[model samples]
Target chain A: MREFFERLGLMAEKAVVTTGQIIIMLFQAVYYLFLPPFKFRNMFKQMEFVGVRSLFVVVLTGSFTGMVLAMQGYNALKRFGAESLVGPTVALSMARELGPVLTGLMVTGRAGSAMATELGTMRVTEQIDALYTMAINPVKYLVTPRIVAGVLMLPVLAIITDFVGVLGGYFVGVKLLGINPGVYIGRTIDFVSVNDIFYGLTKSAVFGLIITLISSFQGYHASGGAEGVGRAATSAVVLSCVLILVSDYFLTSIMF
Target chain B: MVKLSAEAKVGIFVLIGIILLAYMSLRVGGMRFGKEEGYTLTVKLDNAAGLDRDASVKVAGVEVGRIKDIKLQDHKAVVVLRIKPGVRIGRDFTAALKTSGLLGEKYLELIPGSPNAPYLEEGEEITRVRAYADVDKLIADLSEVAVDIKKVTGSMAKVLGGEAGAASLSNIVSNLEEITYNINAVVEQNDERLSTVLANLEVFSDSIKEVAAGLNVLIKENRDDFTAGVTNLKAAMETLNSMAPEIKHTVSSIQRIARRIDEGQGTIGKLINDDTTHEKLNRTLTGINSFIDKTQRFRLYVGYRGEYLFDADDTKSYLSLRIQPKADKYYLIDIVDDPRGNRRTTKTEVTEGGSTRTVETTKTSDEIKFSAQIAKRFGDLALRGGIIESTGGLGADYYMFKDRLKLTLEAFDFHKDRNPRLKAGAFMYLNKYFFITAGYDDFISDVGLESAYVGVGLEFEDDDLKYLFSSVPPISF
Candidate 1:
């Protein structure tokens, strides 16, 4: 029982230390963001990698998600003689909740892991120390551009998701389910608003900051060579997805 | 197309995302670019529970505006409406919150009250608002009704539960059946008689229809005669209508005379009501009867004469009635309208400015004058001595040519300061009832009051007078 207690204490201590490290790294990245010697090129590159590259997968997921939502909504609302509500159901879901959350998870899996792997390889191969010896601040050079890209690009990606999702819902509701075209479009416009889309984008922005910061934190202190790099990548992807989902609920509760 | 660099690709992607967001905001979300093109009005609703901001405002099922905002004031919903620029909301309009479907979004509906009502200006309140019916309240009321129904149904079940109740119901049914059976039997017994009566009625109705058709044909054939008769009747009615007032005046005068006699107000009334006056009138009538016995053979000639005077340039008229008691003896009475009038001279003493003097003035009055005369004829020569034109006078008439022509001379007023008036005239009779006369009046008067006159006269004897009186229109009393 003592050993068990000791083990629990040690795990708790490690969790606290990791949480503290992540917070400190976030502060450093934000501080460097405002400092001079800005890196527009790196930001553009990261934006391309995170937002542009992920467009295909985001569109695919978003559209299918909306189509399924319309089918299910039609089935349920049909019982109540309200099949026309399917358009609004799909639109509101994508704008207020699904659009930002799904994009965040997708980008985390695709770009967050890559970022962690690249930083982890640098930490393990002593390149980070070499940068320190050359009086270079590694966090500013490596993490700031990524955080900037994420803060900027995640909302852009969410906007694309929301647009495609609404289109897919319109196609499925009007063409497949045979809802009145005017009613479908009219109801969607009546129910959805810019504020709802902005809510999702706001959440995406928070999620973007989370994805980059946690990934950088996990990979920046990596010690083992190949195995640690792999572990860091996995942890970055896993932690980002979990944080994105959990934070989404809290944000929705507060903002809405 | 040129191969796009990574940075260019990223810029394009960001731009696309922004453009899409903007499109959604403007098109789908209905966000405006500049100032909204509308006027705003306020409406207060009683239970706008399901209404939302930005809800459509429709007029007769067509959208013309939007609900810009909703506010809670004094526990009521006050909605601010943004209406399209050209759409007018009359002052007499009702705003109602209505749902599209059973569970749809709430919208504000504007129902205009009158077409010609003046429009409501900007920032005006739409005071006529319809109270929204809440679904929950309706459901609650329905539940209450359902509870009452359940109680009623429970009572019904209790009342009809037992064997006794069932027996009573069966008894009622049996009684109804017995009544219906009796009624059916009665109807069956009388069925033939009822049909016979119905047939008779049908025949009677057909005969009546034939009679009516005959009447219609008769009326159509006599339409022109009917119109002519109607026109004649209308003309007669108009004549009577015009004479109504004159007839009423005559009747009223007769009534007044009768009432005066009844009230003992006039000579006739005194003679009837007073014993002494009655005795005196009876004695006088008895004495007059002796004279009337001789006058019982009396013949009356009523005549009128009109004359024009050359010097005066005016006309005189006389209505005369002559009574012939005998073949040679007659009395004449005349009512005359004289243009010369009656003349009187007076002297008045005046004391003005300490001097006494007398003023002589002559007065002339245009009063109607009367003449009563008696005449006696022998051998076509007549002599008259009586009042002539309101003065005592003597006159002689000489007949010529079998009495078809006559010559007359008169003198009167000898007491006046002027020479006694003398008049002469020649009369020519065209028939037994009509005569023309030319005369010189007051020719001997030194006051130069002489004038030559030409006159015509009509006389109706007793038989002719009776016919004339009978022809006059009758006046009802």
Candidate 2:
């Protein structure tokens, strides 16, 4: 039991330190966003990787989620003679909640782990120390463009997801279920207000910042060999998902 | 020429990323920042069901515009609709709130009324518009009505009972007893009367057969007589036709007399038409009353013996009597007689062997009595039992009723298998001579079998027959 207590103490200490590091990293990312000498090329490359390249997976998840929601909602509402409401129900749920959160989780899995692993590898190999010795600022070089790309591209990805999701609902609700095409589209538009889409985009931007800062903090502090890089990658993905869910609730509550 | 700064690379990436992000946002979000490309029309709705900022507006299933914005103003929903600029809408166009599908969406559907009407200017309101009635509320009302129907049917069932309310406690026992008694009585009464009626029917049928046989023999024996009678009738008709001119002249003279009376031309005609004639007739009737009074004041009695008896109660002593008695200066009379009494006393009684049997007996008195009976005559006829009896001959009387152009035919006691007692005839009208008549009678032997007949006739009338014959001589002999 004493040993268990000691282990708990160590875990608590590590958690505190990690939390402080994440807060400091968030501040540094915000500071870099407004600073001069923004890296447009790296930002573009990162944007392409995060936004454009992520399109297929985002669209696939968004559409399948919307279609499944429509199928399930139609079955439920059909019992009450309200199967026609499936289109609007699926659209509102996707735009206000699922679109941003699901895209955040997806990009975290795809790009967040990659960013952490690469940075963690450089840390363990003393390459970050080498940049300092060569009179180079690693934060500006490695972090700024990724932070800019993430903040800019994530909201774009969320928008794409929202559009594709609504279309997916339209297909299932109208073409498959024989719901009137006009009614499906009109209900979707009427049910999902502009505020809902804007809120999701804002959530996505915050989630993107969280994902980058958390993954970079873990990677920059990584010690040990390849195993530490793997651990950092895994922890970054898991932590990004957790922060996204927690922040979504708070954001939704406030916005609504 | 060798080195590029890290900041430059980062700057380029950031700039490109921003541009791509902006472009993507504009494309995916469908954000159009410039001016709208259509004439705008605004419609207000209480509820805009599932309409959005960029929702398509359709007309007759054709996409023509988009919904620009939806807002609530003064507790009423207002939807700003933007139509394509080149599309011209007439002023008389009607806008109806329509649904995409059952639950899909709601949009304004414009139905153009008249093409010749003036076009609606841009940004003008469509004053005439209709909202969609909520189908959900209608369904709810139907369900409520169904519930009421169920309740009413349940109450009706209770009121009607299981056997349609036929049973009442008071009648149950008494009705059953009465029904049994009536059935037994009817069965016994039918048994008694059935045989008697059958026996009587058999006798009646035998008599009918005998009568039919006799009728057949009579008809066969008189066959030639019937033919000769028909021939005699034809000869009589020819002779009557030879005398028709004189008859026609007499008919014309009578018609002229009737016409003069109708026109109040002669003295009798004036009596029929003038009030003074009526007054004079009334005075003459009053004078006859005074003469009858004077005659009644003379009392008298007369008697005469009669050999014949008019009734079985009359005896051999017969007399004819007429008596009048005076009472307070007026005369009154009474008469009584038995004429058959005298005839009965004088006749001999005969038996079946044609031998007379007589016994000496005193003769009863028989009397013949006479009394005055006064009756007034109207025109040339007297009415009795709703039939007219004329002082003139039957022919003239017939003519007076049905003129000379009219023929009175009576088919009396005519026997046919279908109609034994049939009577049918036609009377032709004068001038136009179109006569309509109908007859219906039962067959004597066939019981209920009967025959009906209808007849039409023609006649001609002329005042100057000689002149008419001279003007149009016969074309064929």
Candidate 3:
């Protein structure tokens, strides 16, 4: 029992330290945002990496998520003689909850891992130290562009997700389930408000910040050799995913 | 394809995303473009519980605009509705909160007032607002009803719970029984008086029969005297021929009197010669003439029927006259020869040699019974009431199949000593004048007054009778 408590305390201590580092790293990224040599080129490149490359996967995930939601919603609402409600059900779920969340997880798995791996490799191979020796600010040069790109592009990706998701729900609800097309669209528009879409976009923007900052922090502080770089990349993806979900709950509670 | 730079690819991706976002916001989410289109109106509602900001405003089920805002004022909901252009509303328009489906979103519905009504300006408050039917209030009312029902049941359980309640119920039953017994005793006490009234009715019917018999006797006795008077009238006709010259002198005097009246020389002359009074007298005579003409045009039918009663083994005959003034109204008179005579029974107790024996005597009278009735017809059914077979009665006849078939029912002779006589029959018309009828009479009685009867009848209008007489061949001497 004593050993278990001691291990638990240690785990708690590690969690607090990591949380503090993430917060400080977020502040530094924000501080570097207005600094000199604004890297528009690098930001574009990171945007393409985070948003453009992840488009196909986001579309695929969003469509099937909406399709499945329609199928399940039809089955449930049909029991109450309300099969027409499936359109609003799928739309509300995608706009208010699933669209941003799935995009965050998907981008975290793809770009977040890449961010952590590249920075971890630079850190371990003495490239970041070399930058420090050459009188260059490493945090401003490396982390700022990725964070800016993430903050800008994730919402864009989420908007696409929401668009494709509604289309998928429309296809399934109207074509496959035999619901009237006009009624499907009317019910969807009736229930889903602009604030609901904005709610998802806002959550996605926060998730983007979380993903890029945590991954960058993990990579910048990476130790040991090549194995440590791999570890950092893996931890970045896992941590980014967990934080995205965790912060989503807080965001939803506050906004809604 | 040209190899685009990463920045160009990212820019294209972001541009598409922005376009999609714009479509979602404007088209799907119903977001206005820069400036909101349409004018806003204010309305006060009793309850706007499910209605939200941005809810649709519909006119005739077509979406015209949306709700801009909602606020509470003086314990009422004040809603701001933005109405689209080209949809003009009047000040008398009614605003109501309506739900789309059973568990769906609420929308504001603007019911347009009359076309001639004055147009309502923007930002004007709509005074006519209808309260929505709320599901929560309905459920709350249902719960209150359930509580009242529970309270009622609880009180009922307290009042009728045990042996005391059972005893009270028995007491009520005994009281009802005693009341019925007292009514029976009262009826028994009036039994003799009821018999006396029935005996008086029998005497009245006998007097009517005696009057008819006496008239027959008086006619027979006056036959020879009537012949002697006819001979005396012939001699008087010859004397009138001798007085023709004297009659002419009297006729001249009457003509002189008429000449004086024509000169307007007396009271009778003024009455006859005054133009207004003459015109009034002429109009009154014409009115009376028209009324008589109308009555003369009324239809008259004479009919004969004979019914064979199976149980009584007797044939009853009727000579009937029917006078019809309008298509739906008629008077009927029938002289019936009923073989099953009117019966009067008398009972008396005789005590002889210390033993009392009751003797029952029955007297039967064979007399002509008459029926006079008035009937009014409505569509295929005719109702009649007056006197049926010498008794006050009611009857109905249902005609079907272009009046080819008739179902008839009658009830009469409601005596205290017996059940009312009920007769039901069907008449099948063979042609305009001939019909066959079958029926049960006095079926409500169990003392063997009931009989099954079949009859054949012939009916003819006055015109038909005249045509029959005209068609007959002349006899040669």
Candidate 1: Cα lDDT at B268: 84
lDDT of 3 at A2: 100
| TM-score per candidate, chains pooled | 0.56, 0.41, 0.56
Off by over 4 Å in 3: A1-14, B31-34, B37-44, B89-97, B108-477
In angstroms, the error of model 1 at B147 is 9.9
Model 2 bad stretches (over 4 Å): A1-17, A32-107, A125-138, A152-207, A224-227, A245-256, B1-33, B40-57, B66-80, B136-477
Report lDDT (Cα) of residue B98, candidate 3.
Answer: 93
Ranking by lDDT: 3, 1, 2
RMSD of each: 21.3, 35.7, 32.2
Candidate 1 TM-score versus the reference: 0.56
Mark the 10 consecutive residues where model 3 chain A has the least summed lDDT: A186-195
* DockQ, 0 to 1 scale, candidate 1: 0.55
What lDDT, from 0 to 1, does candidate 2 have? 0.67
| Candidate 3 C-alpha lDDT tens digits along B281-381 | 99999988875565556677999999999999999899998877678988899998989876656678999999999987878776688899999999999
